[model samples]
Target: MSRGAEARQGLTLIGPPLFYALIMLAAPLAMVVTFSFWTQDYLDIDTTLTLDNYREAFSQPIYRVLLLRSIVISLVVTVTTVILAFPMAYFLSFKVKRRKTLWLFLITIPFWTSYLLRVFLWKVILGYNGVLNSALQGVGIIDEPLTFILYNANAVVITLAHAWAPFAILPIFVAMEKIDRSLLEAAEDLGDGPVRRFFRVTLPLAMPGVMAATIIVLIPTVGDFITPKLVGGTDGLMIANMIQVQIGRANNAPLGATLAIISMVVVSLIAVGIYLAGRKFGGRVE
Candidate 1:
């Protein structure tokens, strides 16, 4: 076929799905961006463009605190998930000689149930008289149930980390699997210990997967409202929860949209920063 014909044929194949994606993804985002510039008064939306929402989102102490807390919580969850997942991924990739598929299946067992169910299960485990406290009491470890575990940021972190574990593991596992085993063997031959070999050879090559997992766990968790709403009480509420309140209870769509936009911008910047940092580190390793 002529190059022009081939190009046309490719466009024909790509056009529909691309259009669908734009409508589904881009349209809502564009609407939110638009809404951020307008003002809403209870039942009526004023079409007059204004910076009030943006100003409030930036200047208000509550918004600032919530946004900061959200970032901190997301960072903690990402770090915890990745740190825990790395060992499991390494075990599956290196230690398991057979039934790796079964192990992976087990890792995915959590997904078999509803996400709401998992969150509720964590709630039950962490509640005052829930399974964990009950278990501890049964064993006489504590005279009373712990109050710090549930209805707070700690609960959010634990639940999100657990939920995102598989996401972190799969990426790192794939990266490790792609690594050439001979590199580690060669490092060992060169008098490098197991730890040294990993840092020099295995870890560097697996950085891409680590980066992927980090981004995967970091982005969505930042904007997660449901987890916080269910398990996170007032002290645990994040930026997303504030946004939800603004849109739902407060009936301020413009302010909510502004918060959402600000969040997307912040998350995008952080994600870009991480990507660049990873690339620089990878380059040095190379």
Candidate 2:
């Protein structure tokens, strides 16, 4: 095939997928936007254009609390994951000499089980009659089970952080691996120490991955209901759970749609902002 023909062929192949994605995506978002502005008739939508849903969403103090709490938890999870993943990624990229695939597989082994099972596993480990308590008692370190370990904010953070650790690590590892080894060698030749070389050379180049990992981990968990519902009690209920309640229990479609739209909008904004932020994080020319 000629060059022009190949170009045309590739475009033809790509166009359909893009078109399909837009149709599938555009319709739902339009519906959400429409619903958010319409009035709620008790539990059903009246579908007439009005600002009740948005006004209701903004006017309520409870919704604001939930929104703020979700953001805070997401931020904590993002920060903690970044810190933990950085060292692991650094070791994986710079230190480990054997079984890279094996190590990666081990990291992903947690995925073999269902996510619900994973949350329950944490519950078991942190429960009063659970493994950690058993170990502590066995070792005579404590005479009683700790009340603060499970069904609290800290437990929520700890569980989400553990669940999201791999999300941060893999991206960072990929970013680190993408760096040219010659740059590091050149830095060392100029008398740059390990610490200097990392901050000056490695960190900057690896920043995109770090940002990607943060976004990847933080976004889903921000809207996550399962982990919080299963592991967290009253304190851990996020905006998603509230959305769920409105839709499931209250049978409030219009309000649920409004909440869903608001959540989606915020999540989309944060995701784009983070992705752009990731792309420009280190201010790297490339």
Candidate 3:
């Protein structure tokens, strides 16, 4: 094709996506920025502007702690999911050839159900007299129920990790599967063992996928209110949960809007940092 033809084709393809992104994302985000500056009284927002919402957020130690804790929990979940997904992705991509589709399908099967239902199911399983306790008792693993399991940090982590597992696995698996088998055979022929080849070749090639998965899982984990409210109790509450309380119970719309904006900024910064870091690391790989 001529250069002019190619240019026209590219524009035609990109125009729709640009329009969609602006309408779907940019417009709503612009509204949030507008709302953040205005004060809401009851259902109506006043036209006046104020910075008290931000000042209040900074003044409250609990809000600051919640923000910090959300970041920490999201980071932990991102790291843990990557570690756990790596081996599974490797198995699907390099080792298991016969049932690859079946395995991938199963990994993503839980997502076919409702997201809220999954959160509620975790609550049921982790409750004091829930399935875990019953199973443990039946098997004589523990004589009594563990109340902490249902409403704590551990429960949130466990449940969110499970919820986010497929997101990490699929991307990593796709990256690993893209690697040519001849590359592995070439490494083996050079007397490189499995571990050496992985570090030198497989891991480097898969870094982009790992980075993609990390960003995906971490963003949702940070903004998740359902997991925190259902599983994480008073001690395990995240920033999102606090924002919910501010808007719902405290009747503090400005504070909630401010917190949401800050949370968005923090998560965006983290994601950008990860993306840049991933690009740098991927460049170093091969």
Q: For each candidate in the order shown, give its overall lDDT on alpha carbons.
A: 0.94, 0.85, 0.87
Would you give me the overall lDDT of model 3? 0.87
lDDT value, candidate 2, whole model: 0.85
Model 3 clashing-pair count: 0
* Candidate 1 lDDT for residue 256: 95
Summing lDDT over every window of 10 consecutive residues in candidate 1, give the lowest-scoring window.
277-286
Clashes of each: 0, 0, 0
Return whichever of 2 and 3 wins on lDDT: 3
Q: What lDDT score is found at residue 35 in candidate 2?
A: 66
Sort the candidates on lDDT, descending order: 1, 3, 2
Give lDDT tens digits, candidate 1, residues 4-102: 999999999999999999999999999999999999989999989899999888888999999999999999999999999999999999999999999
**Top model number, TM-score:** 1
Better of 1 and 3 by lDDT: 1
Regions of candidate 2 where Cα sits further than 4 Å from its true position: 1-11, 42-44, 272-281
Report the lDDT tens digits of candidate 3 across residue range 131-186: 99999999998989977787888888888888999999998988887788898899
Between candidates 1 and 3, the TM-score winner: 1
Descending-TM-score candidate ranking = 1, 2, 3
Candidate 2, clashing residue pairs? none
